[model samples]
Target: MDDPQRSLLYRWPTAAKFDRRVPKEKLYEHGTGTPAVREKFVAEVQRITWAFKLAETTINLAGNTAVPEIQIFEIDAKGTNVTEPVLTAIDKAIPFPIIFEINRDDGETRSTRMVAAHKQLGSGAPKIGAYYSTGWQSARTERQSLPTAITLPALYTALLDPLTPMAARPGEDVSEVAARLKAMRKLEREIAALERKLRTETQFNRKVELRRALKTKQAELTMLVER
Candidate 1:
């Protein structure tokens, strides 16, 4: 039988950064019901698990139906000093535009505005929206209630619509960010392979060669990172 859900198995190379930096951090703990969320969740799993059987099972399970429409994860930093750190990390990790809602301990919910709304600059280039809003149902205002469900079609529209620009953060060049990410991911894979080879090879000369290759790969990664 043809696997319809195989289409959801897109690669998420940037997810490895989270894996390397925060090894113990649980991923996909909360599901985002939209296809966008499903896509992201699948990528996170694939980034961590190398087993083909596991990936296949996951893909089959996810193919059952649309997931819920939740963002990457929700933070309950209300009245907490660590809110900025949590928000900052989220901003750095997710390049695309998203909406965040902050619910206070008093049962009051206020939105922190959508990260990047697209606007037309006079020079014919698009810019992130200056004004912040509560929800992302439309680009016009911020007072709308949270969406009850995010279908696959809605998620696709949010991402692919050219009229609705999705780049939200300041000074964020989507194409540049994407290119750098691709390079870093490639370097990461090369470094991993070299390290694995180093572990299994006990010959003194081969070990030295592997170490040298590892160092060179690390250096390349560093340069791309520092750039």
Candidate 2:
């Protein structure tokens, strides 16, 4: 397995810094909804800061129409974990794609993790895919320079590559990698279900059938892995 903490953190340029503290109320006002989500924010999130903005103007990279700017938001977490709903709410409220840095303090030590979903802009709303994250590392972990790219969209893809479960194949972009990951996730779930069913089956014929189905799912997963 690759070290996720390696080449994963970037030293953002001072020219692109947007050190604004984003109020939780502002997120709710901008369309992050439901009483449940609001409550989660209150209970689990201590602060939200708009830490940096990567754009053509700030970074000298050309911007794509679909991805004009990338925003980096840092969340000071109140607990060890922040649920998906909390993240989804923030993604929905923000129009642009965002990279989240979640920081937590355990009194003796401070740790940080990176989390984000592949966000796409459609005609009506921004479509967010499953989240990808890195395991927690010390706050003092060494940082790396940003991935080399000529455009914001390309840079976005490069940044997300490290967080994905599978390495991107030659000629594959972020969207393609995301689609493959979704398929892999589906196959994983089906394989688990089949294995569980096989464990308790007593009849010889039923066990045989379950095993056949489980083998098929496992083969499919293997193919995806090889890709």
- TM-score, every prediction: 0.31, 0.88
Candidate 2: clashing residue pairs, number: 0
What would the TM-score be for candidate 2 when compared with the true structure?
Answer: 0.88
Q: What TM-score does model 1 achieve against the real structure? A: 0.31
Q: State the displacement of the C-alpha of residue 137, model 1, in Å, after optimal TM-score superposition.
A: 24
Per-residue error for 201 in candidate 2, Å, reads 2.9
- Error in Å for residue 227 of model 1: 4.2
Against the reference, the lDDT scores of all candidates come to: 0.36, 0.84
**For candidate 2, lDDT tens digit of each residue in 192-221?**
999898998899999999999999999888
Q: How much is the lDDT of residue 131 in candidate 1? A: 21
Please identify model 1 stretches exceeding 4 Å from their true place: 1-96, 99-172
Report RMSD for candidate 1. 19.3
Number of the predicted model whose lDDT against the real structure is largest:
2
